[model samples]
Target: MAVWSLWSLLLWEALLPPEVTHAQVQGQVGGHALLVANRPSSFQVREAIWRSLWPAEELLATFFRGSLETLYHSRFLGRAQLHSNLSLELRPLEPGDSGNFSVLLVDTAGRAWTQTLQLKVYDAVPRPVVQVFIAVSGDAQAPKTCQVFLSCWAPNISDITYSWRREGTVDLGIEPSGLFTDGPALRVSLGPEDKSVAYSCIVSNPVSWDLATVTPWESCHREAGPGRASYKDVLLVVLPVLLLLILAGVSAWHLGPCSGKKKKDVCADEVAPEAENPLV
Candidate 1:
């Protein structure tokens, strides 16, 4: 019986699952930090075998090797339950911990299983900053009417470029000036037809890009009176009607004691004692 038992223990230990460890970034600030852990997989192992042939905690401890000296240990998983699983967590993790770790698992018959896992850490890209400015490229009023000037600025990024486009075929006379300035400003003029024209300035860096556009001054702002509708006109014409409809719907649905669908339809009647005294 003892010999058979020893053979079974060796066989089970030989077939143990490979142990695994990993680090996941739950959260971090300036530098990267991570959680680390080792897990065991023995779900199908019979409970009887687990109780009779499992190795001591010290033997299971031998399979793991790493220094948590500089790593900030998370207290949650430090001590593990027996015959269950094991895990270790570290936070404020730095790049130095990026390496392979070796761990061991052994069964009672002195059979051993081994596993190795690799960890890595990295820093995120920094946020880019942007600036905007305005420039004038040509005369305000010219007889040809084609020669109006304006330019815009954006943040300067290497290898990224910019260009200008107009809403209508009517040209505002944009000359590249064969010059490039690292600013987020646009300069251009609209014709009499362009009183409502839309113009835009674009800025792009290798990592990111953004746009700032200015619509025709007339659409953006109003001089008041005559053509423009007043705020009072909108409030008086639309708001009260909408509010009355909302109030009527709410009152019809929930204001009464018998408002809901399940209420009884019939009411109890009370007999009147009319003229009882005179009749009697």
Candidate 2:
């Protein structure tokens, strides 16, 4: 019985494909994943086979000489392709399609080479929404700069990270502990210099990223402080008045009483008209 068992083990080992280190590949839903075989082009190949082993071991495709064959009734039938170079292509990938895939390349001399890969699929992340609000610092009566809280959120995502930046500048590098809430938010004190800058929030996961931006003038609503006026607000109120004043000055210079003809000619014409009436 022991001799028979040993023989069976040897047979099983002989049938198994050669072992190689596995590699990881990442893909998104509605995309494609390619598994490349590293076989040397100079090596003559008689046949090749591709299989999947996770969830269950199943034959995926086979290549004989110059011809290719895919499993007719398999779930991957219409979406899998075997290339002449012993590479496999899976298209229109779904989340459930991620798992282990293996390729076995058989040389014309009856020797086989094999490799395995692990695939991971993720859903694309959507754009994040950012909200900003003012939070008073210390006591309300204490003359302190107001703190602004920025909240960033995305739906139906996990394992996400948040980053902040002042637009057109370097990253804000806000620490996680500086957030007002415990999650994806940031707390910052608004300095006089910050009023003219725009802040952006970036949210990301392993697969994708998104951004949202807010300007300090538009996002934070407050009564103008004693001597503080937003540059944007000042421009909005001052620019139109300045334009109107310029227009009025140009009109007066072009159309006023002294604009056309000489004053001496008018006086001479009035005196000549009186002399022509000459009853005195």
Candidate 3:
């Protein structure tokens, strides 16, 4: 048994690619991941056991005499299968499925071979939010144009990339001055002609991508002149003040001292004649 194990180890070393052992395999959520054994086509497998090593070492699936055994764990039931190539397939993978996978294969000659693989599963990124900033030129006489800065963002994600598309095209060779591309943002000065063009921001990771679109007119508004106010906005503010002034004038007119008639003075008759008659 020892000699056969040593021989199987040597065979694996010769057949396995170097990258398969060194790099971690990435899988998308709700997708499938394959753990390859890289066994030679000529080799006949007698038995195999696929196991997980992280969170806890647990048996995932098993094969005996070229047939799958009845001892699959509940977590992998209906979702795991062993292929003829000695590869294990896990379907509908989830974020919690990320871990180390190990496979032990025994050949027809009772030779034991084992391999371990690292798997990482990630959730699909959400649709990105695009924010726009407009910087107006100080000079009024200059063309009625402004610098537009666009930023794309996705929350709670890492290892993401950002790309910008203008009018469904990727080329920006003819961009105007002040145009710049940063990590997740694009800054450009837009003239009148560019206002009608559509822009899109794409955010992606290894597993998934999301996109957001906007037009220059939607993000940027024409600069308002000094003291400029829309008629609706002016009416909204002025109507309330005018109503209050009219109410004040009406109240004052009703409550003021001059609103009521003045009272008349009364004169009493002299009582001296009455007093003299009583003395007599």
Indicate whether candidate 1 or candidate 2 has the larger TM-score. Answer: 2
By summed lDDT, the worst window of 10 consecutive residues in model 3 runs over 260-269
Clashes of each: 14, 0, 0
User: Which sections of candidate 3 miss by over 4 Å?
Assistant: 1-23, 110-112, 170-182, 222-280
lDDT of 2 by residue, 24-103 (tens): 88887798888887776676877677788886787777776577777545668799988777788889888798789887
Q: TM-score of each candidate?
A: 0.26, 0.65, 0.65
- Tell me the tens digit of each residue's lDDT in model 1 across 194-262: 556655555553333555455543432332224676566777978999999999989977765454454
TM-score ranking of the models:
2, 3, 1
lDDT of 1: 0.39
Total backbone clashes of candidate 2, pairs 3 or more residues apart or in separate chains: 0
Off by over 4 Å in 2: 1-19, 139-144, 171-183, 222-280
What does candidate 2 score on TM?
0.65
Q: Between 1 and 3, whose TM-score is larger?
A: 3
- Can you write out model 3's per-residue Cα lDDT over 75-174, one digit (the tens) per residue? 7777888777668888999878888887767677655566778999888888999888876456663665667788889888877888877764435567
